[model samples]
Target: MHLFRGPGFVAGFSDRADGSLDFSDRTPEEAGRLWAGLPAVAGLGLPPPRFAHQVHSTTLLRVGADAPAGRQGQADALMTSVPAMPIGVFTADCLPVLVVAGEAVMAVHAGWKGTRQDITGRSIAALAEATGVSPARMQVFMGPCIGSCCLELGEEVVEEFRATDPGSLACFARGARWHLDLRGLNVIQCLERGVARAAIRHVNDCTKCLSDRYFSYRQMRGRHGTQFSFIARLPEEGAPSSGAA
Candidate 1:
């Protein structure tokens, strides 16, 4: 679904219906063949989308016009100001966040570890510094992810977040087990970095809860394929923003 559409950019999250966008367990040749058929990437008139090895770390890669098309490296986020060059992240239950500021855009993969490391905040800072755009002027769009209702975490994991970001304690709940709000914590990180609350939008669908529509790692028990979430700044002469697909 299209998460954000402006005069200069378009950002959206893909679903199972769009086909798995990551290689995962598939052979390289099979993956490449399947990627070629993905409807989301076909007919966009943009260059091949850029992705990263997503190690669940806070590493952020910057993509320029000259950057190569395939896997860029190990990173949880990708940012660029180059028009028509799409950047994205693959995720199953982890949050896929898209940020836009004028001509600059970022696609972030915020799994629990990345969130604990404040990847969202770091991306905002990096993009703002690179584009000279204030964090307040940036817009954030979050895609499907595991929600508190289904994201039961162990006490050690809960303590890890609590130790690093005490303020994140508010994002946890005590049920039969500790449930964490991955989306809410990222929103808090964005707000802490000066992004206006009104500027943040998200798809409320829980990946685990909506397994039929989205890929959910937890629901699939480590056998899930990932869907892609992407954004690109269109060239001046490119087509106008078309919301969703």
Candidate 2:
């Protein structure tokens, strides 16, 4: 469903009810057919959303109007300023973040590894630099993912985060196991990059907790389906094109 809609863009986060949108396991031809049948893509009359082969890295790819309809390359984030073109990412429990700045939009996939690399912050910075827009002017939307209540991590993982940003330690809680607040840490990263608190929105739903409504890789023992989250700059006649190419 659409989580945020503005005069020049729209962002959506899909659920299990919307059917599996993950095409990684399928052949290219099969994946293309499945993508074409999605109600979200067909109903909106949009081309197949541009995405990438997410390897949990901080790599970000830029999509132009002439970009292909499917997988663009190996990256964890896709950013675009082309109106009517959609960019997206797929996730089962990992976080999906959608960003909008003026006429530019981006879709990011942030797992623990990506978060450790501050992918969200880097994406915001890249977008700001590319579009000539301040990070404060960007709007961020976070989609469903494993929450702290169920995201148990190893001590090594905690140490990894500590190495990246010592202040991020606040996002972890000690108990029977180390519980990491993945979403909270990303929010902190965004705030550090100048994204306003009031400009951020999150679904707050835990994929593991609501397995019936969403997909959860951990809850499903590493075998789980995935959902798609996307954002697009609409082709409005009089919309202001303030962001960079």
Candidate 3:
């Protein structure tokens, strides 16, 4: 597993070393035990992890302060300001985004579908409204996903981003085939949402290219295996305050 300490909270991305905790293969009960086995997640006294069916939709769910079971809701994004509430998203190649404000944390799963819908841009706006924080004050971390070298796509995909942003056409390239820069697109979204350039960080790994370290749905040839990326808000006082927690 890898950890991202974005200023005020803990964000983690699991890897192949985490075993087959993909919810697509094992039952939820079984997957839970596998996830809890990771050293980073073990014995931290974290709150129950929550996830959705991940239909690649743009639905964003916010967890309330008293929400312990994490709502069990169906959404591609989950956010919470409640301390210890670990919100997560499972992905192999698709982007996993974590946004953190002073007291709020958000986990986003941005696949092509959700990306086309501008989920990251909307998440910042939504979270800012919910937490009453400036978007510039939030730090964002984008986890490993399929990079452009490995993200070949049809011309239609290129046209899709162009039709949506037009300026986003810069992020797409024409080679033997078209390639979409998912990470770049998300970064642009954050910038558009008023997040500072320095506040955004990316793991910058290509999952399909580095399948040995991380799981890749494409590299695995449609395998159900996936790694989880999570973020949680820690308590105000005496909280560890940073680094791969």
Candidate 4:
């Protein structure tokens, strides 16, 4: 994956599929104690970042400086053309999709449900409508997630792929059950949706295996921290350099 420079935001994921935050690890009171200090966290030199409660459903919003706060919408993905308002997504084994268009960038949380529901397409369409950017002009970065080598699936998942994209079944391997490549499926979706191949970069990092720098819920047996993937359009004045993790 391309290195991301901070003063940006982060998304966390688990290893297996449920890569959500381990609230049990810290009580709401403790989290509140931490949340109380978020402004101080915001005080650090970085672009102001915001996120949403992803529901694995296809709901995308374009955030501006005046947008309301408090998870006002339900969406698996979010995009923004507004400068300095960074968008972020959370995942573990599921894919963390980041899209950039000139000065605008988008962060997507694409779990299997989001993927099957075409969350990427919805987000892109919204951005296109909002910014008038053609898909050819877009750059996509597919971050590390669960690889097909270990992302075994059942008939339900397979059926979902077939229902959405019948040809995607080729990415599935038959065994005692089936091993699938979710990243590959996402790549196919990107290409089919008009994102140029050369413009799309796949980090190909597997969270389950790359435990040193990333958190894998599957490898950790459902008890682990979540790593974040975030991007922000630089401000005209004194923007931080760009990198990736």
lDDT string, candidate 3, 58-177, tens digits: 888877765534235678998876777788898989999988888788999998778888998998899999889999898888999999998888988777777877887777888999
**Which model is ahead, 3 or 4, in terms of TM-score?**
3
lDDT tens string, model 1, 94-125?
A: 99999998878999999999999999999898
**Model 4 Cα displacement at 156 (Å)?**
2.5
| lDDT (C-alpha) at residue 45 in model 3 | 63
- Report lDDT per candidate: 0.85, 0.87, 0.81, 0.66
| Number of backbone collisions per candidate | 0, 1, 0, 17
**How does residue 212 of candidate 3 score in lDDT?**
93
Per-model TM-score versus the true fold: 0.90, 0.92, 0.90, 0.77
Q: Each candidate's root-mean-square deviation in Å?
A: 3.7, 2.8, 3.5, 5.9
Q: Work out candidate 4's RMSD over C-alphas.
A: 5.9
Instruction: Give the per-residue lDDT of model 2 (tens digit) for 1-245.
Output: 54577777778998987788887667657766776786666665566678899999999899987886777889999999887778899998899999998878999999988998999999999999999999999999999999999999999999988887899899999999999899999999999999999999999999999999998999999766898899988756485643433
Against the true structure, whose TM-score is highest?
Answer: 2
